[model samples]
Target: MTLCPSPQFAIPDTPCLVLDDGAPSLGESLHCARDWAAQLPRAKYLVLLCERRSHFILGFLAAQMNGMTVLLPPSRAPGAIREILDAYPDSACLVDDGPPPAAAVVRNCRDFHPIRSARQPASGEVSVPPEHVAAIVFTSGSTGRPRPNPKTWASLVHGARLAIRRFGFDSRHCIIATVPPQHMYGLETSVMLPLHSGARVHGGLPFYPEDIRLALERCPGRRVLVTTPIHLRACVSANLDWPAVERIISATAPLDKTLAAHAEDHFKAPVMEIYGCTEAGSLASRHTTQEDDWLLYDDFQMTVHGEHCRVTAAHLAEEVELADVIQLKTARRFELLGRHADHINLAGKRASLADLTARLTAIPGVVDGAFLEPASVNGATTRMAALVVAPGISEARILERLREQIDPVFLPRPLVKVASLPRNATGKLPRTELLELYERQVMRR
Candidate 1:
């Protein structure tokens, strides 16, 4: 909340982003935020493309200095970019090297420049109100359209401090994160933790198992790898001598118990899995091998309401409904029961089926449509299937229009021509029937 940067945090006059190794320093990167605050108006919101760690952190802090909200869009995917662009028409995209090819088609680019001075912003003694929305992050929406969730600076910091305590992050620690800095989990752990603790963060999203090992090799002293279950599995499978790696954090998707066991056995490091989504920064964390309850972020309260999980965030000063279906044990700790019906899983990532269905059914030519996964008829088809209703539109035209909006994974296969999809009393769906319908209508025929 304090506008003045922490004294313990060391800021060098040198560049944060290294062109040779493509690694950016925290101080140098945050300096860009300061520069932007000085340039932009006090109330202008900034839309930052989270392609790299350097750009994400810089854009975030810059918004804070300017007292503007920051919007972080997931990388690369055109549908994801278009959604954010449509949502925030007045926002400017922060493109470091060059504006992304997809974003270029949407609007003119306002290029960002590196900070030249070390002076802090004018609001040195300011405290961001707990109610103020500091940033907006979209849930990856495994089913339909991605939903935007706004988070206050206080809430974000509160969650980060809670994470710092559980993970034992301190000034002496250095991290090499494989996760993108834009997403909530990655943003808090990789960027906020460093600024909060005055620690160093190696800017890299190591993709390959060997790359993860190399990142550790490049960074010394209490190196932690913030990654996913997919990357963790690959890292263990690589069987590299990664003695320098002390801690590992997995998020974004569910971590298999079998893979967690394999990870600790091979790496001799603790595998800590964080639970939460873009909506709630991070609710709690449980160690892979330990039995300790997920230490909830300070000021957070959880309650199971019927089949859904709800949260009372004292930091945000608001109550939020979470996608997770949790078993309420107390206001703080509880076991997770996968996702709520708000999201349906297909091909590893979760999508918003409700949002997709709404979009398809709302179109002019389409009367009513249901999007479901196609079953494996002869056990040959690998992807899910869907059924739609468009009496006048051709299959190619229907697919083309939907493709312009939704991610490819959510795209319906075979484009089953249907009169109308079955809807319940509240126009709802039964999970089993949705899958069954897919099998009968699309798979068999």
Candidate 2:
């Protein structure tokens, strides 16, 4: 489990990061990392709060060089930041382009500049031990309380290498990612992939479809758009003229086959979906339009016993239990049934919430929706409830359409039409938020 056979940055003097201002070479990035590392306070842990992708990578490398554990919060919410700080009292904060949250020790990355005099000692090949904790990425808290998953340098680098090979990426590819840098998908694809695979990443995190189009137009060479299903749906529905995209990568939520086919037809590129979690990183990927089963990455093994399955990889510290139920076709291929926690049985019938939601969003005139299990009152079982955002569509009309697709018992009883679902940056619905919405909107009535 060697971190790197030879200690060195991948490709220097190549365009590694494409920022709004200008593209930064790997050499310059290494120089900035050296300067940033010199200014970091002596702390065992540091909270990385960089909104920009380039700054996030710089901070990550600087922390790695300084031998400090980087704590990647699930979100920048005040409560989430406070929880991490409380968990690690000896931690400090690092900011690149914004004011630091209330903390005793904070370092601003904007203050650091590449120093020529400081280049001698720090310049040259950089390497870290296989066991060094590169980062502690927290889960999305979609199911329960957010849990921290520590990733080692060896694991992170190994995963990056696998991604590079899986995607067939080379120095000619430029990535324009819409997801936030804090999320695991964004961190691995937009951050680590470029560092390890010799590809360049766009610095801007564009959300609007027009902005994404403009960002892609600005990038040169073969381009790859790393985004989620929500963003892809919006982009495809908008029907805006797009540049030549070599490929599109989607994750963080299940991608509908219809949408995937539409995106491929519209963009003239294939849509590759990555299946993974915060605990195991990226384990497998598939082309939604071409395959029903996912192909596992090299050096990874999947073992299933009864209803539970575990994944083991060279980069992983141990075998990780998968949250989703899978139908294993072979050692390297499987079809995802659904999340183990998302399956529910009522009235002697079984259904998956994910499947229901997918069908809900597929209906005409339905923008977004979710199926939730409302809290029971006085030990009385309750039927599934729905929160939807469909303007100018009647609840009866939506239900009429749903009746054709799902069984009567699985259909949502009270389909509460709302403005939108409370989705995080990565387009994942938190269970707590869904419960709150149900209690506020449906329960009262």
Candidate 3:
């Protein structure tokens, strides 16, 4: 708890955000946040749509200071934006990008400058009630429709402090994140961690391996790369000379160990994975190359009965039941089985879709892949189908390899070769999109 930003946090003069031009101190950012908050339109919720990390942080703080809850949409898709806006009638959209997506009272982040030095408020510190609702983060709609999860200010701060200690992060470490701030994983590592732990974060949302490399090069210190499994795979495969990195953190989807090892070898940095969901900001961490069990952060407790697991913590208002299957190894350690949704019972035989997909992607020429179990029709289960991204490997060859590793019941009926999977920024394939792809490519054939 030594690194935890106190409940009555005092703003610091250390750099909080690193931009191409210069680094902005925490106090400076707060000053601008208050100024911008005063001008923003009155609303009960602020739907943030800023692409720039700096703007997102400023908007996040401004909304909170003004007592407006920040609403993070699951994605930038028009349908997703509309869904959130329709649900929250008193929400205003804030965007730094070109134009707003929906028909609402939209405000542009470009209209206000957050880095402009101005007269500091008399207190020079931001203090909000611990019970204040900070943000409502939406779940990634991988399985189904995105659901909102409200997070309090105290919970956010507590999660960040736990992360800082777990990752050995401090003000001296510079964060270069590929994931966008709207995602809960990105919000914790890229935004909240720095705000509470005194770490400096690069403002750019780097996606390409080269962009990530450049972002790391520009920062001066031990650098941490906050990203997802898809981004890590791209970086490892790029084969470009990477900059010195202190560590690499990945989440949003389960990371393949081989890819994690390759990334660690290439970057000469330890690769770590986070295990959590939108309901809980971040729960545990594990060094991928070293172990399969996840070590829960201090004060987190887990209990399992049958296949369902419930997690409890002081920061959480109530115990949260996890959707995934878990095996408790100790009081604070556990092994994560695939999600309940990914478990398939086919022809009296059971198999995990996630495990099968991992096996397919582990093939020599496979770039990416996923196993899809279509909905049952007339009480009869359908054969599972697969989508693969291996230009060098044929559908037959991929199936042959899968046959050796998995049971015959689990082999894909028609493994469709594809250019790419429809992965979002966080590397999650939405079920709706996957089914659409299946219909367009498979049924049409």
Residue 383 C-alpha lDDT in model 2: 85
lDDT of each: 0.64, 0.85, 0.87
Q: Give every collision pair in model 2.
A: none
Clash count in backbone of candidate 1: 14
Kindly state the number of residue pairs that clash in model 2.
0
What is the full ranking by lDDT, best candidate first?
Answer: 3, 2, 1
Expressed as tens digits, the lDDT of each residue in 22-139 for candidate 1 is 4444444555566655665433567666555655666677667667788776544566677777777666656545556355322212455743345433222335665667888766
Q: In terms of TM-score, which candidate is stronger, 1 or 3?
A: 3
Give candidate 1 regions above 4 Å deviation.
3-32, 36-43, 103-132, 330-332, 342-372, 375-445
Higher-lDDT candidate of 1 and 3: 3
lDDT of 2 at 292: 96
Return the lDDT, model 3, position 282.
88
Which of the numbered candidates is closest to the native, going by highest lDDT? 3
The 10 consecutive residues of candidate 2 with the worst lDDT sum are 115-124
Q: How far is candidate 3 from the true structure (C-alpha RMSD, Å)?
A: 2.3
